[model samples]
Target chain A: MAFKTSVQKYTGSINKLEFGSGENSKALGGENVLPFYTFDGNIGGKPLIGLEILDVYPEKWLDELQQIYGDAANNAVQWARFVEEKFSPDFICLRLEGADPNGLNKSPEEAAALAKEVAQAIKVPLVVAGTQNHDKDTKLFEKVAEVLEGCNVILLSAVEDNYKKIGAAGVLAYRHKVAAESSVDINLAKQLNILLNQLGVKNEDIVMNVGCAAVGYGFEYVASTMDRIRLAALGQNDKSLQMPIITPVSFDTWSVKESVASVEDAPEWGSQVERGIAMEVSTAASVIAAGANAVILRHPGSAETVRKLADALINN
Target chain B: MERFMIIGERIHCISPVIRKAFAERDAAPILQRAKEQIDAGAAYLDLNIGPAERDGEEVMMWAVQLLQNEFNNIPLCLDTANKKAIEAGIKVYNRDRGKPIINSADAGPRIDMLDLAAANDAMVIALCAKEGIPRDTEERLTYCTEMLERGMALGIDPNDILFDPLFLVVKGMQEKAPEVMETIRLISEMGLKTNAGLSNVSNGAPKHVRPIIDSVFAAMAIQCGLTAAIVNPCDQRLMETIKTCDMIKGNILYADSYLEL
Candidate 1:
C-alpha cells in the first residue's frame, strides 16, 4: 500500500535494454516505470560501478584519491588489478588520459599496450576510455579496440567529431561495445548514437554517455536532459536513442575544485576526503537517479558507498 | 490517483459490419484490428456492442468470447446501452489481461451498476453527467463525490472508479472547453482519477485540426492530473503528443543516445 496505487499496476511492465555481451556485458537492470521510483515496485541489482584507471600518473589528483591509489595510479595494469581484487568493482574503466594533447600526449601504441594488459588482467568486463580530445580519442580507441578484441569490452567514447573511426573499430574489430558521449546537449547525445549505428554498430552494443558534470555546474540541466531522453526512449519508443547509459562520475568530479582544491581554498567545502567522496557520490547518484545504467568512479570507498545506496534504492 | 490507463477505442460493433462479423463468430476482421491497435500501444479495447436491442446479451457474449479467445485474453471494456449486455459480457470475460471494465455508471439510474461492479471485483467508469452535462466545475465535483461515496459503500477502492469528465466538443462549444478542463482539475484535486473520450473534445472540428486540439487538451489535462483516457490509437499524432508530454512532465527519463524505455 505504500506504493502509489496509480503506479502499482504498471510497475514491472517497463522494459530495460542491457548492453554488451559475454564476460563484460551489463544486465541493464531496474524497474518502476521510471528511475528511482522505489515506492512502486522491486528494484534489484546494484548500480554497476566502474573503477577508473588513469593512463598516466595522476600528478594532479585530489589528495584523497591519490592517497588510496599511490604508486598503482601510474600503472594501468596494476590499477586495474588492484581495483578488481581490492575494490572488487563490477567493472574497470581505463581512461587514456595521457594521450590527450592537453595532457601527457602519449602514443596510441602506449594506449593499446595498456588496454591489452588491462583487458587481459581484468576478470570482469573492461571499459576503455579515450583521452577527451575528440580526434585523438578516436585514434586511441581504435588501437585499444583491437587489443581488447573478443573480450566483450566497451569502448569509452565516440563523439560527434570522430565517431566513425571509433564506432567502426567497435563494430568491425571484436564486435565490442561503444559509448557515445555528447556535450550536455540532448539532441547531440541521440545524434551520436544514430551516427554510431550508421557506422554499423548494433543498438545493443551502444551505451549513452550523457556527459555528467559535478554538482552546481549545470547539474540539473544535465539531469533534466537525461530525463527527457529516457522518456523519449521508453514512452515514445524512439529506437534511435534506446540504449543503456554510462556516466563518467570520477572524471567529472576530478575536474571540480571541490574535489581537488585543498580545504583551505574554500573553508565551507568541508574535509577534502569527505568533500571528494561527496562530490563523486552526489554526481553519480544524480545520474543514477536520472536513470544511469552505469557510472565510473575513482575512489573505492566512494564507489562502495554509491553501490550500497544503489542496491538499497533498486531493491526497495 | 493511479497511473494513466489508455483505453483503446477501436474494435466496436457498429463499424461497418464489423460487429456483424464478430457476432457471427468470424474473427478475421476483429483479430486483425485487435493486433493493429495493440501493436500501436493500446492498453484495452473498448468493446461496444451498441444497442443490439433485440439480442444484446447474445452479441456481448459473442464479442467478448471471440476477442478474448483469439488475443490471449485481452482485457475489454463492455460498452453497451443495455446493462444486461454489459453484465453478460463481464460474466464470461477472462481475467488475465486485467479486470473487466464496465463502460459506465452515473449519478442516476446508472448508479445501480456500481453494486454489480463491486460484486465482481471489476473496475467501472463513472460518467459525471447525471441529469445532463454539468454546467460548471462544481457540478462535476458533486457528481464525482456522489459516485465516490456510492463506490465506497460497495467497498470499492477509489482508484478502481475512473471518472469521465465528459470532454466537450471544441468546434461549436469552444467556450465550454475550458470548463471541462476545470472539471478535470477539480476531480484530480479530490485525489481521484479521471479520463475522457478524447476524440469527443475535437468533434465537429476539421479533420487535421481535431487531433491537434485533442492532443493539446490531453496534455493540459494530464498536467492537471488526468490519469486515464479513451483514445484512438490510429491517431499517430495524438500518441506522439502524449509521449512528448510525458517526457516534458518528467514521467519518463531521457534515454541515452537512444530514448529511455
Candidate 2:
C-alpha cells in the first residue's frame, strides 16, 4: 500500500498569469492537479463564480429566471449592483447581447461605455462578453477592453475564427484577459490554445472555455475533455495548453427547459427551483472535477449551491 | 528505495550490434541512437544488452557512463536478465540523477529481482505478467496487486515500482485491447502511474500502421489515466497526437486561441 510519492511536476513549459494586484491577485492561479484530488496536492481555492449581467435582459429567457432579477434587467448598472448585493458573486460577467448583428447592433464604443459603467459599479472582478457573432464580438470586445483599463477583468469567448483581433485587443487595450472557447471536441480545444498563444497572449492571461453543456446532455463529454486538459498540464507538462478553464454553468443550466419549466412538462421532474439547483450544482461539480478554474452561473440559488460545493471540493 | 524513474523500452534500440557496441565502448552507434532517442524526447536511455549477457556488468557500466558523460548526466535503465550486470552498472552510476533501474521484476521467481532492486536502493519496473501475460483485466490486476505487495514487503515504494500492464500487440490479440486499457484505468484510479512499452502495441503490424496504432493506443491509454510511456517522441504523428490529445482531455489548458475546435 506504500505508493511511491513524488511531486507532480508539469511536463510542459507554462507561462503564468497575475489576476488582481497584491493579495487579491495572488489569490488566483496555481492548481497543480485536477480539482478535488486531495491525495495529490492542495486544491486550495474554489472555482470563482462570476454572475452574468447582460446589458439588456435576454428576451428569450425562461419566465422563472426573469422573475428573480426583473427589476434591474433593463439597466446595466443596476443589474451589476443587483447581482453583487443579491448573490455576492466573486466576479461580474457583463454580456453585451445588445450588439448582436440582428439585435440592437450597438457599436463597440457604446458597449464599452456600458461595460465601464458596470465595472465601476461592482467591487468584484468583471468578465466582459460580446454578442456571439464572431466579427461583432471582436470589434465590440476591443472597445470594452479599452475603456475598462486597470479593471483586471476577464474577456469572453475568443473563438478561432476571430481570435487575432480579439486577443490583440484584450492584451493591448485591457489590462484584463481572454477566454479561448472550442466545440466539445478535444482537438479543437488544443488548436484554439495554440492559436491564442501565437497571438502573443501569455498562458496566465487566457482562460479556456471547453464549452459547457447542461447535466444529462453533453456535460460528461465536457467534463472528460476538461479533465484531459488538466492532466496534460499537470502530468505531461504541456505548456501551450496550460491555462485555467472557464465554465459558463448558468448559461448551460438556464438553457435547459428541465431547469425552469413546470412539473406539468414532466410530473416526474419535481420542483423547478430544486431542479435548477440540482442541474447547476451537478454541472459545476462535473466541470470542477475536470479542473475548471472558474464558472459563470445564473440563478441566485444555484450560484450559492455551487459556491458551497466548491469550498468542500477545493478546500477539503 | 529512491523512486527516480528511467522510462525504457526496446523500440528505438536500432542496432544489431548493441551488445558488441557497448562491450567495446564503441561510442559511434551507441552514441547515435542515444542522442536520437533522447533528442526525440527520451528522458532516460534504456541500455538492454540481451543475447550477449556474459559481460552484463562490464557492458552496462561502460554504456551507462558513456551515455551519462555525453548526455550531461542522463540516467539509464540497466536492462538485461543478468543480475551481476545490474550490480556492476549501479556501482559506477553517479547518484546525482538516480540509481540505475533494473529494467524489470515480477511475480513467480522473477520476484527475486524486487529484493535485489530494494537492497541496491534502485527502482525497478514491475510487470503484471509473472509466468506469462495475463489474458484478462482480473488476472492482470491480480498480478499487479501481488507484485505491489511483494515490493512493499521489500520496503520498495510503489511509485518506485512502475506497473507495466504489458502492452499487447493488437495484430495478435485485438480483442484484448479493451482489457489492457481497463487495467490502465484501474491503476490510475488508484492514483498510481503506469508506463507501457508503447511500441509493443504496433509490433508485427504494417509499417505505416505502426505510428497510427501507437498514437491511437497512447491516446486511449492516456484516457485510461496512464501517466507516461516508453515511446519515441520524435514520431511526429504520434507526438502530435499526444499533444492534441492532451489538449482535448484538458490535461493542458488551451493556448490563446489554438485549442478552439
Candidate 3:
C-alpha cells in the first residue's frame, strides 16, 4: 500500500497576530500544527526574526559587535537605521536596557523619545523592550506606549508584576500589542495570559514570551515549556495559551559565558566572535523548533542564518 | 476537576509476550509491563485476557492477585469476553487506590456485566453500541441511554459507569470521527464520564503516524469532554499530548515536570 500521511485535525490555532503598522507589518502564529509540521496542517505565517537594538549606547558589548555597529551603536535611531538598511531584519527591537535603576538610570521620557526616534527611522515594525525592573519598565513602557501611540508597535513585555499597568496603557489605551513575559514555566505563562485577558486585553493584542535561556544553560526548560504551550494551544484548543510566542534569544545567548568569555580567558573555546554568533544561532534555532512564533536576535549573522532556517523550513 | 485518567492497555492477550506469560502463568513479563505503564503515569491497568473459556476464572484470579500483590494493590480493569472471568478477578481485587472497573457492558449480550458491576460495587465501561459499530451519534446515544438506565436500575452510581463512545478507525470510518466527539459531548452534557479505546482510532495506520493520529484524536476528544481513555501510556508522544491536554483543560495543575508525572 502506498503510504498515505495521516493529517491532524486541530480544533485550536495560534492567534495570527500582526505587529507594527502599514506596508511593513508582519504577522506571526496562525499555525494549527506543531512547529514545522506542515505535513499535518497549516504552518501559517513563517516565524519572524527581529534584530535587537538597545536604546542606550552599548558600552558592555564585545569588540565583534562594536566592529559591526561602529559609531551607530552610540545612538538608538542610527543603530536601528543601520541594522534595518544593512541586515534588513523583519523588525527592529529597541530594548531600553539603560533605563534600569542600577544601570544608566535613563529617564522614561528619554527612553520613550529614543524609542520614537528609532520607530520613525525604521520601515520595518518596531518592538520596544524595557529593563527588568518592574517599576522602571512600567514607567518606561507607559511613556513609550503613549509616545508611540497609534504606531501599533509591540511592547516587549508586560510581566506578572506589572501586567496591569502595562496592559492598560499599551494594549488598552494605545492599542498596542503586549507580550506577556513569564519565566521558563508553562503554568506561569498561561496564568499571565489569563491575567492579561481578565484585564480586558483582547487575545489578538496579546503575545507571549514564555521565557528564554541560552543553549546548554538551562535551555531545555525553555524548549519544553514552549512545546507544552504550543501543544496545549493547538492540541487541547486552549484559548489562554493560543497567543504566538516571541522569545528574546539575543539577550539570553549573548550574556552567557559561552558567548561573552574572552578568548584569552578561555583559550580552548575558539574565537569569541564565532562563539557568540554560534550561541545566538543555536538558541534561535532551538526556540524556533520548540514553537516560538518569532525570535529576537543580536548579531546580523545570527539573524540572517536564523531567517534562512525559518524560510527553508516553513516556506517550502 | 479530576485529572484525566489513563487506563493502561498494555497487558492485553493479543501481544504474544503477554499471551505466553498468561499461558505459562509467568509473572515476570506481565509485572514488567504493568510496572512500566504505572511508572509512565497510567491511573489504571486494563487486564485484557481475551476469552479464557475453560480456565477464564482461574487465569483472571491469578493475574489480578499476581499484579495487585506485586504493585502495591494497583487499581485495575478486568477485560474479557467471559463474565465469570471478570467476577473471578474482582474477587481478589483491592480498592485501596480505586475500585476495579469491569471492561465492559454493552446494550446487547454483555448487558449483564452491569449487574456484575453493581453487585460488586465496581466501575463499568459501558460501550455505546449493541453488536457492531453504531450507525451514527444518535444510535450511539440510544445505546448509551439504554445502558445508563440499566446501570441506574441496577442501583449503580452513574459516575461508576464510564460511557465508551467506541472509537472507530479513521482509515475507513473517517466520517465518523466527528460523531464520536459529538457522542462524548452529549454524554458530557448528561453529566457522565466518558472513555474509549483511543488506539482504535489509529488502527491500520502506519506505525510512524499512529502516534500523531491517536494524539490528535485524543486531544480533540478530550476537548469534547472525554474524561478517560484506555491507551498505551508507553507512547511518549501520546502521553505528552495527554498531559498537555489535561493541563490545558484545568484537570491537572501545570508544573515543569508535568510530563514526568
Candidate 4:
C-alpha cells in the first residue's frame, strides 16, 4: 500500500510553434505534460502573452481602459511601441477592428499598410488578427500576407469557412503561422487543423484558437473544450489536435460587464481595475492549467501578473 | 505527426553480432546495425554494451561516441546492468537530439536506478516486477505503483518513467499474452505510457513467424495504449504495420506520403 502515483504519461505533445523572425522571435507551446506540471514533463516554452491592439480605436471600450493609454491608444504604431517598451509583451496582436464591414469598413489596403507600419515599429512579433468577417479576413489577410512577405508574423486567424484561402496565403506568401479558430468544439478544432494541413500549412504552423471567454461567459464550456482538446492531443495522441493553443483572454474577459462596471455600479465587486485584472488573469490561469500555450491579453498589469504565474509554473 | 517512439533493440549485447563487435571493439558492424534501424525510422537508439564488470565504461563511451558521430548525434538508450556503465554512456550522450534513456529499473532490486535517472535527469524504462515477473495484472500494478511513488518522491517527471508489463513469449504462454495486453489496457487507463520489448513475445520462435507475432502484438499493444517499444525497425513489414496502426489510430497526421515520416 504505497501512495498510488497518479502520474500519467502522454504519447503526444503540444506542438511547438515559432512566430516572427530573428532575435525577437517567440516560440510557444511544445509541452509533453499537462500545463504548469513541470513535475510531469517538459513545459516547453514559457506561456506567452500577446498584447492586443486595434487597427481602429475601439468605440465601445470602457473609459478606464481609454484613460490608461490616452493618446497612444489612437495609433497602432505608437500603441505597439508603447506596449513593447512599457509591458514587454511576447507579441503585439493587431485586431483589424476597423476592417469589420459593420464598423469603419476600412479597405484591405488600409489595414495592410497599418499592419506593416505596426510590425515595423515593434521589436516583438506581430499577430495581425482579422475582423471575424469571413469575406473580409480572406481579403485582408491576403494583402497583409503579401505586404509582410517573409516577415514570419502570426496571421491572426482562419475560421473553418475560410481557412483554405487564408491558410494558403499564410504559407505561400509570408511563411507565417496561421491561427486556426474553432467554435468551442473539439471535433471542429481537430477538423480545422486537418483542413489547414491539407492546404499545405505544416502542422507546426497552425495554432489552435478555440475562442476564449470570461469566467461567467461559458468559461466552463471553453475550458472543457481546451481540456478535451489537450487530452485528445496527448492522452489519445490525436495528431489533428496537436497544434499549440492560443487563448485571447482579454478579447472576451475585458469586454465583460464585470470587468468594466464602475465601483458605484457594483460596490460588492470592488474596484473595476481589480475586478478586470482578476477576471483576465484567472481566466488565463485556468486555461493555462488546461493547456493553453498563449494568452492574448490587453491590460499590461494583468499581463505581468499572469506571466509571473506562468514563469513560476514553468520554472518551479 | 504526434507519433509514439520506437526504440530499436538490435544493438543490444545479447545479439550475437553486437556481442562480437563489442569484443573486438569494431565500430563497423555496430554502425551498420544502427544505420538499418535509423533508416527504418527508429527514434531512439538503444546501446547495450554488456555488463561493464571491467571495461564496460570504456565500451559504453566508445559505442555512444561512435553511434552519435555516425548518426549525427541521435538520442541513445543506455542498457546495462552496470550502473557505472550507464553513467559512462550518459557522460558522452548528446542532449541536442533527445534525452538519454536508462534502459531499466524494476520495483525490486534495481529500484535505486530511479536515483540514477533523477541525478542524471535521464528517462527510464521501469519494469513492473518485484521478485520475478508478476503472476497477475494486480501484482504487476502493485509493482508499478511502488516504482511510480518512489520515482515521484525523488522529483522525477512521471512522463519520463515509462512502464514495461514484461511481455511473455507467446509460444508457451499463449494465454498470458492476452493478459499482457489487459495489463497494458489497465495501465493506459491509469494514464501512464507503456513500453515492451517487441521481440520478447516471439523469442525462440521460427524466424518467419517472429516478425508476424511481433507485428500483431505491436498493433494490439498500441490499441491498449503502449506508446513506446523496442523492436527491430529494419523489419519493413513490421515497421509499416506500426506506422499504419499509428495513422489509423489518429496518432499521426495522415498524408499522401506518410510512410516516409
Candidate 5:
C-alpha cells in the first residue's frame, strides 16, 4: 500500500477580488494553498504590485525619490503618468494625504478632482487611499467614488468607526471595491469585514488591511497575523477572512528612520537609495510570503524588484 | 467552551440508510455520511448501532475497523446498549487519534460499563439516572455522584468520565425543561465536563420547529455551562447556532468566517 505524505486539508478557497472592467484588470486571493506552497494546492492568483502616487506633495521627500520624478513629483497627473510610462505597475494607489488635518488640508472636492485627473491619465485601476482621517476620508472617498464610477476604483479604507460610510460609497453608489482596515488586531480585521458584508458588499469586493509595519519594526507580527488570517479563511473556512489580504508598505516604510537615514548618517547600512528600496522590497516580500494578495509600495525601483520576486515565487 | 466537543450523531443505526448500509456492510453510504460530518467540524462520531443485540459484536467490530481504515484513526464513540458489542469495538479501536468512548454507563445496573471503560482506557458518558430521568437538579446530582464515584473507584481518570443529564422531550416535559439546564449547570460547576443528547429536547415537535428549538436550547445550555453535545452535525441551523453561541460567550475565538469553519 502506498501512503502519501500527510498534507494539510484546506476547506475554503480565497475569494478572488477583481478590479477594473476589461483588459489589464488585476486580481488576487484565489489560492487554495499557503502562499507559494503549490506542492500542496493551487495558487489561484499571483501577488501583484501597486505603485503609490500622492495627491499631496510632501515637503521633505527623500532626495533619491525626488531625483527619479523631479517635476512630475509636483503634479498628481504628471506623477501618475511618469510612473506608468516608466514602471508600468499593475495598478496605481493614489494616497489623499492633503486631506490630513496636519497636511495641506485640501477640501474633499479638490482631492476628488486630483483622483479623477490621475485615474483618467492612467489605464490601470486606481486605489484611492484616505488620509487616515475618518470624517475627511468619508467625504473625500465619496467624492472620488462618485467621480470615478466606472473605473472600478478601490477605496483605500473603511475602518470599524466608519465602514458604513466608505463601504456605502464604494459598493452602494459606485461599482468599486473597499479596503477594510483594522489595527494590527486580526479579530478587529474580521469584525470590519463583517460590518462591510452586512452593508451588502460582496466578500470578493473587499480587501483586508490587517495593518502593516516596516521590515525592522515588528515585521514578524504583521506577517504572522496575516498568515493566521489566511489559515483561518482557507484552512478553517472563515468566511469573514476569505477576502484578499492587502497591506500598505509605502507609507509605513518611507516614514521609518532606517529608510530615511543618509549614507553619511549610517554608511554601514548601505547607500540611502538602496537602503530605502531594500526597506520597501523586504517588507513587500514579508507580506507576500505571509499571504498578501495585494500590496501598495512607494518607489518605482522597489516595485520593479518586488514584481520580479512575486513572479518567481508564484512560479515556484 | 474554548473549543466545542461536537459528537456527530449521524451514524445512528435507526436511520433507514444507515440500517440498510449496516445490514449489507456497504461502506459507501457510511463513508459518505462520516465524511460529511467531519467536513462540518465534528470532533468525534457516536456510532449508535441501535439495539444491535444478536450480531452486535460482529457489526460493532466491522464498523470500528471500516471507519478507522477510511478516516485514519478517527476517534469514535461506541454507542450501544450491548456491552459486549462495545467491548468488541474497543478491541480493534485505534488509539492514535484518540481513545474510544463507551456510549454510556448509568447509575442503574448498566453501571458495569464503567468497568469496561476503565479496563480499556476509554472515556464514557455517565447518565444521571438509575431507572428514569431525574426530577430535579438535586436528584440528578445524586445519581451523577454515584456514577462518578463508581468510575473513580474503578481507576478511571476523572477527565475520562463525562456526565450527561438526560435531555427529555420538551413537547411533553414543558414543566421539566429548566431542570435539565440546572443539572448541566451543577455538573459543570463541579469542574466536570457536561454533555447532553441535545436533539431529545425537540422530540415529538413538528419537524420545522425542531431545529429552531434545538438551536435556541443549545445557546441556553451553553450559557448554563454545557461542554459537549451529541448532535446531528448535518443540521446546519443547529450547528451554526452552536458556533455563534460559542462566539457570543467569548469561549471560542470569534472570526467572521466562523460559520464557514
Candidate 6:
C-alpha cells in the first residue's frame, strides 16, 4: 500500500479576525486543521509575530534588549517606529507597563496619548497591552480605546475580572478587537469567551490569550491548555473557543531565569542575548505548535527566527 | 445529567491475534485486552465475535463466562450476527454491574433484536437506519421513530434503547456530518438516549489522523446531546478529548486530575 495521508474533516474553523484597518490591517485564524497541519487543510495565514514595545522607558530590561532598542527605548512612538522599520513585524504590541498603580502610576490620559502616538507612528496593526492590573487596566484601556477609536487597534485584553467595562467601552462602543485573557485553564478560557460573546462582542472582534508560562516554568500547563482549547474549537465545533489565540510570549519568556540570568549568575549559559533569544524562540515555537495563532515576542532576532519558522511551516 | 458512556471496541474478532485467541479459547489475549480497556476507564467492553455461525452459542457463552469470572462480572455488549449467540451470552451475563447490551438491531429485518432484548431483559443499540444508509435526517428519524415505537411496544425502557445515528465514514461522507449531528439532536430532543460506533467516522482515515477525527466528532456529537458511544478507549487522545468535553459540559466535576478519571 502506497502510504495515503489521512486528511481530517474539520467541521469548525477559527474565526478569521482582522485587527488593524486599511492597508496595514492583518488577520489570523480561519484555519480548519490544527496549527501547521497544512498537509490536512489550509493554515489560513502564517502565525503572526508582533514585536513588543513598552509605553515607558524600560528600566529593568536586560542589556541584550537594551542594545537592540538603544535610544528608541526612551519613547513609545520612537520605539514603535524603530521596531516597525527595523524588523517589519506583523504588528507592534505596546505594553503600558508605565500605567501600573504600583509603578510609575502614569495617568490613563498620558498612557492613552502615548497609545495614540504609537498608533499613528506605526504602519502595521497596533496591539495595546495593559498593565494587567484589573482596576487600572480597565480605566487605561477605556481611555486608549477612545483615543484610538477609528484606528481599529486591538486592546490586548479584556479579562474575566473586568470584561464588562472593557468589553463594552473598548470593544462594543469603540469598534476595536479585544483579546479575551484567561488563566492556564481551558474551562476558564471558554467561560471568559462566553462572557465576552454574551456582552455582544462578535467572534471576529475577539482573540484569546489563554495564558503563557516560559518554557520549563510550568509551561506544560500552557501547552496542554492551548491544545485543549484548539481541539475544542476545531474538533468540537466549540464557538466559544473558536477565536484565534494570541499569546504574549515575550512577557512570560523574558522574565524567566533561562532568559534573564547573567553570565556572573550562570557562566555556562553562554551569551545572555543568545540565551534570551533561545528562550523566546523555544517558547514561541512550543506555543505555536500547541496552537497559538499569533505570538508577541521581545527580541528582534527572536521575532525574525520565529517568523521564519512559521513561514517555512505554513507557507511551504 | 447523563454521563457519556465509552464502550471499549478492542476485543473484536477481526484481528488475527484475537481470531486465533477465540478459536483456541485462549484467555490471555482476550483477558489482556479487557484489562487494558477497563483500566483505561471503559464503561463497558464490546465482545465482537463476527458471524460465529458454526459454534456461535458455545463461543458466546464461554467468552462471556470467562470475562465475567475474571473481571468481576464486567458489563458487556454482545456483538454477533447470530441471534442465538447473543441469546447464549445473555443467559450467562451478570447484570449487577450493568444490564448486558444486545449489540444492535435496525428497523428492517433485524427489528426482532428489540424483541429479543425485551425478552432477555437487556439493553439494545438501535441503529437509526433500515436498508443501508438513510437518505437524510428525515429518513433517519423515521427509522428512529419506527424502532423507538417498536421497542416501546415491547415494554423496553427508552433509556435502555440507545439510538445510534450510524456514524458514516467522513472520507466519503463529509457533507453528511452535520446531518448525523442533527439526527442526534432530534433524537435527543425526543428525550431518548443515543450512542454511536464512533470509530466508523474515521474508518478509512490514516492511522495517525483517526484519533483526531474521532475525538473531534465525539465532542461535536456530545454537544448535540449524544449520551454514549462504542469507541477504542485505549486511544489516549480520544479519551482525553472525551474527558475534557465531559468536564466542559458539566457532566463530570472538574479537578486537577480530571484527565486521570
Best by DockQ: 2
Candidate 6 lDDT for residue A160: 82
Q: Write the per-residue lDDT of candidate 6 for residues B1-261, one digit (tens) a residue.
A: 545899999999998888889999999999999999999989899999999999989999999999999999999999997999999999999998899999899999899999999999999999998888899999999999999899989999989999999899999999889999999999999899999999999988899999999999999999999999999999999999999998888655454556764
- Please give the lDDT score at residue B166 for candidate 5: 86
Q: Which number leads on TM-score?
A: 1
Tens digits of lDDT, candidate 4, A1-316: 8887577788779888988879889998888887777767787888888888898775676677778778898898897888889888889899999999998999999999999998888889988888889999999999999898867888878997888889888775578889989888776777777778777788988888988779888889988888878877787667778889888888888878988788999999988888888899899888888878888987888898988887876666
Ten contiguous residues with the weakest lDDT in model 3 chain B:
B252-261
- Candidate 6: where is the Cα deviation over 4 Å? B1-261
DockQ of each: 0.14, 0.19, 0.09, 0.09, 0.17, 0.04
**Regions more than 4 Å wrong, model 3:** B1-261
Summarize candidate 2's per-residue lDDT along A97-118 as a digit string, tens digits: 8888898888889888988888
Per-prediction count of colliding residue pairs?
Answer: 24, 43, 0, 1, 3, 0
lDDT string for model 4 (B150-198, tens) is 9999999998988999999998888889889998999889888788988
Better of 1 and 4 by DockQ: 1
Fnat per model, in the order given? 0.21, 0.42, 0.16, 0.11, 0.26, 0.00
lDDT of 4: 0.86
Clashes in model 4: which pairs? B52-B56
What's the TM-score of chain B for every model shown?
A: 0.92, 0.88, 0.98, 0.96, 0.96, 0.98
lDDT value for model 1: 0.78
Model 5 agreement with the true structure over A16-78: per-residue lDDT tens digits: 988866786788778887988877878878787898878867466787788888889899899
TM-score, B chain, candidate 3?
A: 0.98
lDDT of 1 by residue, A1-316 (tens): 4854555324222234444446456665544456777665544344688888887887777666777877887788888787788888888887788888987788988878878887777788878888778888877888877876777777878887888888887766667777888878877887777777767787777778878889889899889988877666655556666677889888888678787777788788778878888889999888988878789998888898898988777565
Residues A132-157 of candidate 6: C-alpha lDDT, one tens digit per residue: 89999999989999999988888888
Q: Give me the displacement of residue A13 in model 1, in angstroms.
A: 8.3
Q: What's the CA RMSD of model 1 in angstroms?
A: 6.2
